[model samples]
Target: MDRSLILGLLIFLTLLAMPFALPLIGQGYLTGLIIKAMLLAIAAISLDLLIGHGGLVSLGHAAFVALGAYAAAIALQSGIENILVLLLITLALTGFVALITGSLALRTTGVYFLMITLAFGQMAYFTLTSLAAYGGDDGLTLWSLATLFGSNVVQKGNGLYFIVLGTLLASWWFVNRMSQSRFGRVLRAARDNPERTEVMGYSVTRYRLVAYVIAAMIAGVSGLLVMQHAEFVSPALAAWQRSGDLIVVVVLGGLATRNGAILGAFFLVIVEELLGSFIHEWRLIYGPLLVFMVLFAKGGLSDLLTSKRRGNQVA
Candidate 1:
């Protein structure tokens, strides 16, 4: 087996152990934090599939996340109880929206693509705010969460944590597998030279659209999990700021690298939590920290971990 696969396996093992280990140390609350990070990682990994490999920088990815949450929340609010059914609803809504918006967004590239996605995302945000029945700007509180075949396991506690961790791991593996496939190679080719790829008879737009839909669907799943974990969601979940944060996580984790977004999510969340505990204006410190990392750490947090190993190999 490849060394990277071995490394990934070890990391998953550590994550699996944390739920059991953290409580013994009286830091069970950290499990929730881990769940949060994992949720973020799920979304980030999807975004990475777009920006890192497909070279499509979007500013509306979070719209899918919100759509997922809203779809599931509204379904449950209307008496839908089964987690499986809710997931199907969330995927359908998000996928449909992604298909429409991606078709329009794909008409542009580079900064224009970024702007168009932001526009679509804002459209989603405004639409969410208009749903007064769902609490509008105040957000909707899910009075009852989804259940797994009459089991509340996925709705709270360690069950929720493991579910999220499993999802994150699955996402990591899925995206990684896709990135190594022939389709991934073509996507990267389109990213590097579209005209050349078109000359080769590949439909660049089609490839990108598929990638967009895949990413959006993954993000939508993340949103559903987020809603279950928090039990509340607002239109703010679809905002451009949330999209920006996803971008930050992907970039800070290391574009096109396995485990980068996961590491970035954990790092960002832990830093935010630690800083917020000491000061109310942690954002005052946060911006510069990101700036420093972008300027100094070319490959983000993932590189910091493997740089030594790479160096020894080169030597």
Candidate 2:
């Protein structure tokens, strides 16, 4: 097998072993932290599919996440409590929204595209805040936890952790497969040279729109998992700041690297947890930290770590 496959397997094994080793480490706190990291990792991975692979920088990705969360929450409230049903509803709603918004957003490019996406995301947030039936800005709580195959699967911490791990693994595999597929090649080609791709008879906008919708759908799955884990949904999920944070997580992990998203999520969440313990104003630190990251580590945390290995191999 190739080095990337071996590396991916190693990461999967580590995630699988985490829950088993948590109690022995006297650090059950780490388990919850890992779970949250995995959740964000899923989101980052989906965003990476667009930003890193498709060369589509979206600032409104969080809107789909919020849409998924609200879809699941509202469905559960309306007596649709099965996890599968909730997931289906969330995916469909998020995809629909993406389809509509992506068509319009794709009309612009570069900075204009970024601003349009940001605007749409803000609109979604405000719309959620207006839903007084769901507690508006206060958010809405799930009357009951989601049922998986008629069982309360999420009630078990290990069960929930494993489920998320499984999803992450699946997502990673799916992305890798897509990256190697014909469609993925075309998308990457477009990213490299859109004018040439257009001249080659490919509708660049159409391809990008599809990629945007797919990314949103994947993000929707992450949203479903978030609601299931927290048993709550709110406008906070859709906030523009949340979208910014997601972008940060993706970039900090590394652009164009599959594992970077997961690594970035883990790193950022751990840093937040550690810093927040010592300083109540942790974001004060986070702000500058992000600046330094973007300014210095252009390739991301993973790239910095692997640079020596790459150089050695080249030498």
Candidate 3:
């Protein structure tokens, strides 16, 4: 096997063993953190598809996440608690919204596109806050957790952990496949040179719109998972600040690297959790830390690790 395959397998195995090993290491807290990180990683991976592969930077990505979470919460309240059904509803809602917004947003380029997406995301957040039936700004509590085969699988920490892990694995596989597909090639080509792509008879706008919709759908899935794990859905899920955090994750992990997103998610979550445990104002510290990472370690934590590995090999 190639080095990349071997490295991928090793990472997979390590993650697979984490649930079994964490408790023994007295690190059960890390389990929840890891699960949250993995879900965020899934969302980041979706964003990377647009930002990294398609050169489309969206500031409204969290809107899809909010849509998914609210859909799941509403579905559970309406006596439709099946995870699969919730996911489908979430995907449909997010994709439809993406389709509408993307058509308009893609009309502009660069900074204008960013601002438009940001505006839409804030609009979604405000709309959710006005949803009195679902608790408005306070958000709604999910009275029941998601079920599989009539069993509350999500109630068990390990079970929910595995569910998130499975979803992350599947998402990573799908993105890897997508990056190598003909559509992916076209998207990359367009990113490199949109005018050339347009000259070759591919509508750059159409390709970007499709990618945007797909990314929203994937982020919607992350939102569903988040709601299931937290047993709550709120307007905060779609906050513009939340979108910024998603962007930070993408950039921290390194654009276009799938594993980079996963690593970035874990690193950010763990740092927050660990630091927040001791300091209530941990973000005060984290803010500068992130700035340092961006300024000094532009390639991200994954790149740092790879560089260290190469150094050791040389030594």
Candidate 4:
């Protein structure tokens, strides 16, 4: 089997077993931690589609996450409790925002595009903070967890955890298929050399716009899961720092690999949990570690792990 495939399977199995296995080791309480990692992974995966494939680095992608969370939370407050309805509404809002922002952001390249996206993200963050009806700067807490067909299915046991796991798996599969499709090919080609791709008759901007919107919608899904899990919505979810962390996940995991997001999220969460458990000044160590990891781990953990496997196979 391909080394990457083997690694992917191992990661999937570990996540699938976490809800059961953690209890055996007395770490069952970490179920929520793992679920949170998976939820964040969804956002990382969505961001990867842009940074890794389309060569777009968005500093405001977390805005979509906040948008999705707030959209669902607001709906629930208005007496909408169905998860399906909430998800649909979340995606629509995220997509609309992505479309509007992406259309304008795509007109610029490199730093300008990055800045424009960042500006849009700040706009979103402030907009949410100004909505006094929704708790404004203080944030809004959901009255209850999201429901499925009028039942608290998602709130029961590992239901939401498994739901997030399944969604992550499905998203990974979808992104894999997309990365192999003709559209993926064009997007990648454009990323590597826009001039040549345009000469080949592909509209680089159009492909990028589509990818951006897709990514934003996926991030929206992550937001919904986050809101469901935390039972709260705040402007902090859309903060620039959250967006920075999403980028860190992508870069920390390895760019362009389907497994990067999953691996990175797990690694990040574990490191933070471990360090924060002991050190009050954890970021002092964590910050330097990230810089070193990016400096030495060229393709991040995913590529490093897969390459080691391939090397062992060759041996």
TM, every model: 0.96, 0.94, 0.93, 0.96
Clashing residue pair totals per candidate (backbone < 3 A): 0, 0, 0, 0
lDDT (CA) for every model shown? 0.90, 0.85, 0.84, 0.89
Error (Å) of candidate 3 at residue 215 is 0.5
Candidate 4: tens digits of C-alpha lDDT, residues 167-213: 89988888878987999999888988899999999999999999999
Query: Which lDDT tens digits does candidate 1 get at residues 56-91?
Result: 999999999999999999999999989899989998
Model 3 agreement with the true structure over 1-315: per-residue lDDT tens digits: 545445556777888999989899898777887888898999998998888788777898999899988887888889997788888898899899999999999999877888999999999999999999999999999778888868887656889999888989888889878977988989888888889999999998998899999999999999999998888889999998888998888878767764767877878788888899999999999999988987797776666655433210100
Candidate 4 lands at a TM-score of 0.96
Candidate 2 lDDT, tens digit per residue, 1-315? Answer: 655456668888998988888788888768888888998989889898888778778899998988998888888888997888888898899999999999999998878888999999999999999999998999998768788878887645898888889888888888878877887878888888889999999998899888898889989998988888887899999988888888899888877675778889989998999999999999999889999987887778667655432210100
- Better candidate number, 1 or 3, judged by lDDT: 1
RMSD of 3: 4.0
TM-score result, candidate 2: 0.94
lDDT of 1 at 247: 92
What's the lDDT of the predicted structure labeled candidate 2? 0.85
Q: Look at candidate 2 and tell me the lDDT of residue 294.
A: 76
Error of 3 at 119 (Å): 1.0
